[model samples]
Target: MSSKSDAKQEREIKIVGFLCNWCSYGGADTAGVCRFRQPTDLRIIRIPCTGRIDPLMIVKSLIQGADGVLVSGCHPNDCHYAVGNFYARRRMEVLKRFLPYMGFQSDRFRYTWVSASEGQIWQQVVTDFSETIHRLGPNPGLHQTVDSAPAVSWF
Candidate 1:
């Protein structure tokens, strides 16, 4: 694999990852420090907690041409904020099912939990998601049609 072609591939297929600050982010950092090999397609955005992330953010990323979206947070019973991960799990599950209706592939989005000490698991999660995204290819964003077009003007 040539560097030039690899760079081009990375540019063409972008993966956005939203990670929890206290857990998932730390897990990612640990992976890096441990020198675990992972795909470079994932662009990480650290948030305080998955519970605080808006579903629209994922939608916006997909509309903006991101090939995939991966959200990782603390485990169900391990959230620093008590029930934050619970809320996130429900929201992400519904969003996953709803993505196809919005013209985005359901597999383009995924969510999971990873703790700071779980670097190997984080590496595997990222690797698997990256592979899935590579198979999906680039996202064309939401399509507008006569029926799907908005009739109301906000302004």
Candidate 2:
């Protein structure tokens, strides 16, 4: 008989996580150092700050077949770069609402805050997001169905 983890691996799900170096990435590192048990579906990308992540980056991930996209950073008023998290929050919120119109479910995208000392919270965040991605299954991607891609440019 297969174990639970084996069963989880039966289906392939990929979640891309964009973590702010000052906080969320540190939290993930702390979680790893503490040996926290969490799902492995998430692949982390460390960014200087969430504000630096363009909304188009998330869209590109979806179009390239990422099952889910998660953006995490420091709590509001706690960003290392003053207002980076605030900027990130607004951009992500707009993207979240606009996802469905792009043929991608909004639930497959998320944004949250976490500090370096919050290892447990980070673990919970990753676990919940991973479970959500698994439920959504694989992404069909934009280029898969369309013969020609639309011109995507943001000023």
Give the whole-model CA lDDT for all candidates, comma-separated: 0.88, 0.88
- Candidate 2 lDDT (Cα, 0 to 1): 0.88
RMSD over all Cα atoms, model 2:
6.3
Q: Give per-model TM-scores.
A: 0.84, 0.85
At residue 70, give the lDDT of candidate 1: 95
Q: What TM-score does model 1 achieve against the real structure?
A: 0.84
Alpha carbon deviation, residue 67, candidate 1 (Å):
0.7
Q: What is the lDDT of residue 128 in candidate 1?
A: 96
Alpha-carbon RMSD, candidate 1 = 6.0
Worst 10 residues of 1 by lDDT: 1-10
Q: Write the per-residue lDDT of candidate 1 for residues 1-155, one digit (tens) a residue.
A: 46544554655678999999999999999999999999998999999999998999998888888889999999999998999999988888889999887567889889999999999999999999998877766675656655665576789
